[model samples]
Target: MESEALLSVRDLRIAFAGVEAVRGLSFDVRPREVLALVGESGAGKSLTARALLGMVPEDATTSGTVTLLGDTDLAAQRGLHIALVPQDALSALSPVHPVGDQLAAAVRSVARVSRKEARARAVAALDRVGIPDAARKARAYPHEYSGGMRQRAVIAMATVNEPDVLVADEPTTALDEERRDQVLRVLGEQREALGAALVLVTHDMDVVRDHADRVLVMYAGRLTELGPADAVLGRPRAPYTAGLLASLPEHDAPRRRRLPALPGTPPAPGTLPPGCAFAPRCPLAADLCHREEPEPQEVEGHLVACHHWAELPHPAVDLFQEKQHASS
Candidate 1:
């Protein structure tokens, strides 16, 4: 583990019934930085996020070292040093309890404080997340709050204990564009205020571009690319990363034209193809790609896993656009 890393994950693997979902993953979370994990829906991003807090299902088998501040026992430090902001807000909160009371209970679980002090801290956390009239709103049940309010309340609960690391799994997936921005803003603000590192899991590339300091691109339960967000998103080296970015609807492109899309769906676990899992869909794949999987290697400061990453065109999106045109 690096001395400066707040959290370190080494060769993390999660399997179910002899099938691996997250395969041999490694990364480090620096202090007060935003690390975004992105890929298609079945890329094992959510499972990896849950593994950080030892929150995987009972049936799943996990092996790895998730070390936080030199401690490998993640369960012991769960709520106090690490926390999770799950994808669904309504399901995470209890309907019968007032929002404030739930947050107060969270604070009490991690700290030795009087009921009045815990309540005060709970209201303060709510107010800090931009909840209006927090003292009064705190008394309301989860069912009483609006969609966005419930989301904010969840954020308050996660940060009430001031954990060292926060893991949010698709926190803005269900929101509209306006609401998405608001929720991300609140999350960023809370991250800054708490001075804690954040592990953000989402499928939105725009979110990664705007908010992440570093980006980890996963495919078929393995890392495809990892680097500073600006370098990786701006000039993706891996073919899988390039294909994902090319599929996005460009802001300045003609509105009527069809956007480029990846050719096929992600392979199911335990049914991956020989050699590279992405070889079947990758336009740049060669005979070697089908015969041997490429390991991540440093290329211009980015860790890229592709046999021909060096040969990829500077504007990689052009390659995918040309492929779409040829097929048409």
Candidate 2:
């Protein structure tokens, strides 16, 4: 583990019965940095986040070295050093308890604190997340708060202990545009306030483009590309990465009536075919891709697992420039 890394994962793999969910994953997150895991649903994004906090489902088996703050084994130090903002705050929170009481309980679980002191911390946390009338809101049960407010409260509880790492799984999911931005802003604010490293598991490329320092693109239980956000999103090296961006409605080139899309859906987890999991759908897949899984290799300093990455042409930048020009 590197001394500078707040969290380090090496060859992490998880399987349910004979089917793998995450395969040979490795990554590092430095303090105060945001690493986004962007991919379609069932791409192992949530599983990876859950595994980081030792919260994988009971039916699964996992193996990997997850180190936090250099020496702490993440499995042993789950909630004490790391916390999770689960996808659904409504279900994650105790519906019967006052939101404030729940936040205070979280603080108490991680540290020795008096009830009065914990309550104070909880209120402060709520205020930090921009909840109006924080003190009063604390007394309300989860059902009383609106969805956005509940989500903010969940973030507050997750960060109240000032954990070294925070895993936010689809924090903006199910929110309207306004609420999505609000949740994103609060997450960024909280991460900065605590100087905590964040692993944002989301399928929203826009979120990744705006907030992430780097990105890890997962496909079919394996990493297809991982690099700086600009390079991966703007000039994707792997065909899969390019396909994802091209398929976006907003990325359609001028006058292009139909949006481009990858040909096939992701393979079922346990039923993954013999070779590269993405080969079936990848436009640039070659014979090698179907027979031998491509290993992550250095491509201009970034990592991409593609047998034909060198052959894949970077998307034309002028297409976007023209769109911007016309819109302006």
Candidate 3:
């Protein structure tokens, strides 16, 4: 583990019934840094995030060294030093208990604090997340609040203990554009208040551009690229990263133009081919890409796992448009 890293994951692998969902994933998150884990569904982004907090299901087997806050084994130190704001706030919060009670329980579970103090902290947390009339809202149940409010409550609960690392999995997945940005702003504000490292797991490139200091692109359970967000998004080296960017609908594109999409679906986990998982989809893939899996190699300053990354054209340069023009 790096001494300066607030959380470090090395060779993290997770399997369920002998089917691997995450393979050889690794990264380091420093304090107050925001790292976005970006990938489409079933890319193992969510699974990797859950593995960080020791929340993987009983049927799943996970192996990795997650060092954080002096604990090499993060499983034993979850909730005390690491927290998770899970995707579904409704399911994460209890239906029977008042939001305040549940939050107080979280605080009291780890600290030797009085019930009164815990409740006070809970109310304060809600206020910090921009929940108005927090004292009154804290007395309400999860059902009593709207989607965004409930999400804010979840953020409040996750940060109540002041954990060293906060993992928010798709925190704004269900909201519309305005609401999505609002929830994201709250998440960012809470992280800044606690000065905790944040691992934001999402597929939204816009979210990554706005909030992330660093980005990790995962494809078929393997890391395809990792580097600073600006470079990875602007000048992506990995074909998978390029494909994702090309697939995004350009706001400035001509009216009624078809949005470019990656031609094929991602390979199923545990059933990927012997070579690079993305070889089938990469336009620049050659015989070497299909014969030997490429290990992550340093290109310029970023890490990329592509046999022909240097030869491929930049994603921003008419790659997707050329394809569209050819089809038309």
lDDT (tens digit, per residue) of candidate 3 on 1-328? 2478888888998998988999888888988999999998999999899888878889998787777766776676777789999889899999999999999999998889999999999999999998999999999999999988999999999999998889999988877999899889888888888888899999899999989999999988888999999999999998788878887877888778776677688888767987888888777789999999998998877889999888868554356557656777
lDDT of 3: 0.87
Q: Would you list the C-alpha lDDT of every candidate in the order shown?
A: 0.93, 0.85, 0.87
Q: Show model 1 residue runs off by greater than 4 Å.
A: none
Which has the greatest TM-score? 1
lDDT of 2 at 18: 67
Q: Please identify which of the two predictions, 1 or 2, would achieve the higher lDDT against the true structure.
A: 1
- List the candidate numbers ranked by TM-score, top first: 1, 3, 2
Pairs in clash, predicted candidate 1: none
- Candidate 3, residue 37: lDDT: 97
Error of 3 at 53 (Å): 0.4
Residue pairs whose backbone atoms clash in candidate 2: none
